[model samples]
Target: MKKNISLAILAIVLLVLPLLFQSRYTQHILNMILIYVMLGISVNLIFGYIGALTLGQAAFFGIGAYTAAIISTKLGLSFLPCVLCSAVMGCLAGFIIGIPTLRLKGPYFAIATIGLNNIICIIFLNWEHLTGGAVGISGIPYASILGLQFDTERKVYFLLLVSVFLIFLLYRNMISSHYGKVMIAVRDNELAASAMGIDTAKVKVIVLAISTTIAAIAGAYYAHITNYVAPDAFPVMESITFLIIIVLGGAGFKYGPIYGAVVVVILNEYLQYFEQFNMLIYGVLIMILLLFLPSGIAGIVEIAKAKYYEKKKIYYLKEVGIDEMK
Candidate 1:
C-alpha cells in the first residue's frame, strides 16, 4: 500500500514537472533523459540480467531511427507504424547478431558486439541512397496518435513518459515471471543451467532480441522528437554512454536505469561546458564509481534497506526476550 502510494506520488510529480519548468530546453533535456532511461533498461536486460556484455545496442538504435526516418519520410507512414517497423527491424538485427556472437563468452562477446557496432555504423555511412550517408535524414514529422500530435517538447515529454512507464511495467512483469528466473539461472551459471535442461543459448538470444527491440523503440522516439536522424548520433561512443548509465545507476536493480539516466543526462549536460575535458572527466567519474560504489547508486539504497531491516529484526527479537536467551 505504501509502495503504491509512493508510486502514485511520483507519477503526479512527473506529470506536473513540465508545468513547473517552462523552459523548452529543460523539457527537451527531460525527454532525452527518458529516452536514455529506456536505452539503459535495454542494456540492463542483456548485460545486467543475462550477463552478456553488449556494445552493439547503438546499432539497433540506429537501425530503428533509420527505419522510422525512411518509412515516415519516404512512405509517409504514421508514428505508430514507423515505431512498429523500427521495432521489427531492430529485433531482426538482434537475432542475426545474437545467434552468431552469443556463442562467444566474456570479453569475446563484448568484442564481437563492438565489431557489430562498427559494421552497422559503416553501413549507415556508406548507404547513401537509404541512410542519407553523412548528411542524415531531417524534418521528420511530429509523432501522432489518433488525431493528437506531439509537436512540442511538453507534449513529447508526456508521450515518452507514458511509453517508458508501459515498458517499465512490461519489464517488471517479465522479470517476475518464470522466464525471468530462467534468465537469472543463465546469468549465474550458463553451464549449470544447460546441464539442468535450460536452453541457455536460446535465453540469451531472446533477451538480446527483447533488449534490442526496446532500444529501437527508444531510437524511434528520438528520431521523432528531434525531427532528425543522423548517422553520427548512433556512434560506438553512444553505446558506451548507455552502458555507463546502467553501470552507474545499478545494473539488475529495478530502478537502476531511471536513477542512472537522470544522473548521467544531467552530468553530461553540465559537462558539455568543459568541451575537451568532457570525456576525460566522465572517464574519471566512472572509474571512481567502479572503484568505490561498484554496484552503483541502487546498491547503496539496497544496503540501506538491508541494514534497516536487520536493525528492526534485532529490536523485535530483544522485545520478545529472544536476544536475552541468545
Candidate 2:
C-alpha cells in the first residue's frame, strides 16, 4: 500500500513537472532519463535477478532501433508496427545468442557477451546497405498514436511516461511471481537450483529474451524521438552505461533504475565540461559509492529505515516505562 501511494505521488509529480520546467533542454534530459530508466530496468532483470552479466545488451538495443528505423523509413509503417517489429527482432537476437551462450558460466558467459557485442557492432558498421553504415540512417518519423504525433520533447515525455509505467508494472509483476523466486535461486546457486528440479537453462533463456525485448522497446522510442539511428550511438560504452545505471540505483530493488537514471543522466550532462577527466572523475565517484554504500542507493535507504525503526522502538520502550511508573 505504501509503495503504491509513493508511485502514485511520483506519477503525479512527473505529470506536473512539464508545467513547471518549460525549458527544451531540461525536457530533453527528462526524456532521456525515462528512456535510460527503461534500459536500466532491462539490464536489472538479467544481471540483478539472475546474475547474468550480459555486456552486449546494447546490441539488442541497437537491433531494435535499427529495426524500427528500417521499417519506418523503407516500409513507411506506423509507430506501433515499427515498435512491435523492433521488439520481435530483439527477442529473436536474444534467442539466437542465449541458446548456446547461456550454457557458459560466470566469467565465460561475460566474455561471450563481449564477443557478441563486438560481432553485432561489426555487423552494424559493415552492413552499409541496410544499416547505413557509419553514416547512419536519418530522417526517421516521429511516433504517433491515433494521428497524434509525438514530435516535441514534451510530447515524447508523455508517451515515454506511459511506456515506462506499463513496463515497470510488468517488471514488478514478473519479479514478484514464482518465476522470480526461481530466478533468485538460480542466481544464488545454479547447481543447487538444478538439483532442486529447476530448469535453470530455460529460466535463463526466458529471462534473457524478456530483458532484450524491453531494451528493444526502449530503443524504438529512442529512435523515434531522435529521428535517426547509427552504429556509433549503440556501442560498448552504452552497454556499460546501462550496467552502471542499475549499479548506481541499486539493482534488484524496485525504483533503483529511476534513481540511477536520473543521477547518471544529470551527472553526465554536467561532467561533459570536464571532457578529458570526465571518465576518471566518474570512476572515482563510483569507487567511493561502492566503498561506502556497496549495495547502492537503495541499500542506503534500507539501512536508514532500519535505524529509524530501531530508534522508534527504543523511544516506545522509554515511554512505556514512564507510563508504568505513573
Candidate 3:
C-alpha cells in the first residue's frame, strides 16, 4: 500500500506536469513522449514479460493506423469502433505470424520478425488503392468520445492522459499477477519453466497477442489524433525505438515506458540543433548507457536504493545500541 501511494503521487505529478508548459512545441514533445511510452509498454508485454525479441512490432502499429484510417474515412465508422477493429486485426496478425515464427528462439526469432516487418512495409508501400501507396492516406479525423470531438491539442492531451493511465494500470496488474510470475520463470529459464508444466509456447503467443493488441490500440489513437496515416510513419526504426525503450527502461516496471519515452523524446527535441548528426549522437548515447548501465536508468535507481537501505540498516542497528550484540 505504501508503494501504491508513492506511485499514485507520481502519476498525479506526471499527468499534471504539462500544465506548467503551455507552449505548443513543448506540448508536442510531451505528446511524442506519451506515444513512445505507449509503444514501450506494448513492447514490454512481449519483450519483457514473454522474453520475446521482436523486430516486427511496427508492423502491427502500422496495420492499426492504416486499419483505423481506412475504416473511419472510407467506411465512415466511429472512433471507438475503429480502434476495436484495429486491435482485433493486430491480434489476428500476431496469432498468424506467431504460429510459425515465434517457434524460433534468440537471434533467429529476432531475424524472423525483422523480415516480417520489411514484408509488411513493402505491402503498405505498394498497395495503392487502399493505402494510397507511397502517396499515403490523409484527412483522418481526430478522436471523439460520444459526440464530443477532440480536435484541439488540449483535448488530445486529455485523451492521451486518460488512455495512458488506464493502460498503465492494466499492464501493471497483469505484470503483478500469477501469470506474470510464470512469465518471469520462463524468462529466467524456459526449459525449467517447461519442466515445471508451463506451456511456454502458448504463453509466448498469448503475450504476443496481448502486446500486439495494445500496440494496435496505440496506433489507432495516434492515427485519429494526428489525423493522417502513411507507411513511412511506421518504419523499422520505429520498432527499434520500442526495443530501445525496453532496454533503456527496465523490464517489469510499470513506469518504465513513461521514463524512457520522456527522456528520449526530450533528448531528440534538444538535439534538433545537430540535424542529421542527432541520429549519430543518439546511437552513441544508447551504446554508452548499455556499457555503463546494462539495466538502464531504473537499474541504476535500484542499485542506489539498495545501498541507501544498507546504510539505513547500519544506522538503525547503531541507534538501538545493538552494535555489540553481533
Candidate 4:
C-alpha cells in the first residue's frame, strides 16, 4: 500500500510538473513525449521482456492511427470505441503474425519485420481510399472521456498521464505474474524454458499481442492528439526509435521506457529545432548509445552493483579481518 502511494505521488508530480511551463507548443511536444513513453514501455513488453527482435511495431501503430482516424471521421464513432477498436485490430494482427513467424529464431524475425514495415508503409502510401494515401487524414477530433473533452493542452496532459499510470499498473501486474516469469525465463533461454513446461511459442504470441495492443492504444491517442495522420508519422524509423528507447533506457528494467522516453523526446525536440540536421543527430545519438551504453541505463545500474560490492568487500575485510583470530 505504501509503495502504491509512493507511485501515486510520483505520478502526480510528473503530471503536474509541465504546467509550470506556459508554452502551448512545449506542452504539445511534452504530451507527445508522454505518448511515446507508453509506446516505448509497451514495446519493452515485447522486445525487452519477451526477447522478440521485432521491427514492425510502427505498422501496428499506423494501423491504430488509421483506424481511429477513419472511425472518427467516416463512421462517427466515439473516441473510446475507436481507440479500443484500434487495440483489437493490433491484437489480431499480432496474433496472425506471431503464429507463424515467432517460431523463427533471432535475426530472421528481425529481418522479416523490416520487410513487414516496408510493406505496411507502402500500402499506407498507396491506399488512398482507406488511408487517404500519402496525403494523409485530417480533422480528427480531440480525445474525450465520460463527456469531458480534453480540449486544452494541459487537460490532455493530465489525461495522457492517467493513461500512462494505468498502463504502468498493467505492466506491473503482468510483470509480477506467472506469465511475466515465463516471459523472463524465455528471455534467458527459450529451450530451457520450454523444457520447464512453458509454452514458449504461445507465450511469445500472447506477449506480442499485448504489446501491439498497447502500441495501438498509444497510436490512437496520438492520432486524436495531433488531429492528423500521415504515412510519414508511422515510418520504419519510428520503429527504430522505439527500439532505442528500450535499449538506452536499460532494455529489461522497469523504468527503462520512461527514462528512454525522456531522452528520445528531448533529442527529438532539440534536433527538430535544427530541421535539416535532425535525423543525422538522431543517427549519431543512436550510434553512441549502441557503442557505449549497449546495455542501456539499466545496464549501468547493474554494472555499478559489482563496483559497489567490490568496495564494500575491501572495507569489511579491513575492518573485521577473520585471519586475525587465527
Which candidate's TM-score is highest? Answer: 1
Order of candidate numbers by lDDT, starting with the best: 1, 2, 4, 3
What lDDT tens digits, residue by residue, belong to model 2 across residues 42-103?
A: 99999999999888899999999999999999999999999999999999888989989999
For candidate 4, write residues 79-171 as lDDT tens digits.
899989999998898898889989889989998888888998999899899899889999999888889998889899998988888998899
Model 3 residue 193 lDDT score: 98
Tell me the spans in candidate 3 whose CA falls farther than 4 Å from its real position.
1-8, 324-326
Output the number of the lDDT-best candidate: 1
Q: Which ten residues in a row have the lowest lDDT in candidate 2?
A: 317-326
Which model is ahead, 1 or 3, in terms of lDDT? 1
TM-score ranking, best first:
1, 3, 2, 4
* Model 3 per-residue lDDT tens digits across residues 1-326: 99999989987887787788888778767777777788889998888777789988999999999999999999999999999999999999989999888889898998899999999999999989999999788999878899999887767887888888788888888889998899888888999999999999998888888899889988998899888888898878889888888788876666677777878787878889999899999899989988986787777778889899888888899998767533
In candidate 2, which residue pairs clash? none
Q: All candidates' lDDT scores? A: 0.93, 0.91, 0.86, 0.88
After superposition, the stretches of candidate 2 with alpha carbons farther than 4 Å from their true spots are: 1-5, 314-326
lDDT of 1 by residue, 1-326 (tens): 99999989998999999989988999999999999999999999999899998888899999999999999999999999999999999999899989988999999998998988999999999999988999999989999999999999999999999999999999989988999999999999999999999999999999999999999999999999988988899888999999999999999888899989999999999999999999999999989989998898999999999999888888999988788523
When 1 and 4 are scored with lDDT, the better candidate is 1
Off-target runs (Cα >4 Å) in candidate 1 are 324-326
TM-scores, all candidates, are 0.97, 0.94, 0.95, 0.91
How much is 303 displaced in model 1, in angstroms? 0.6
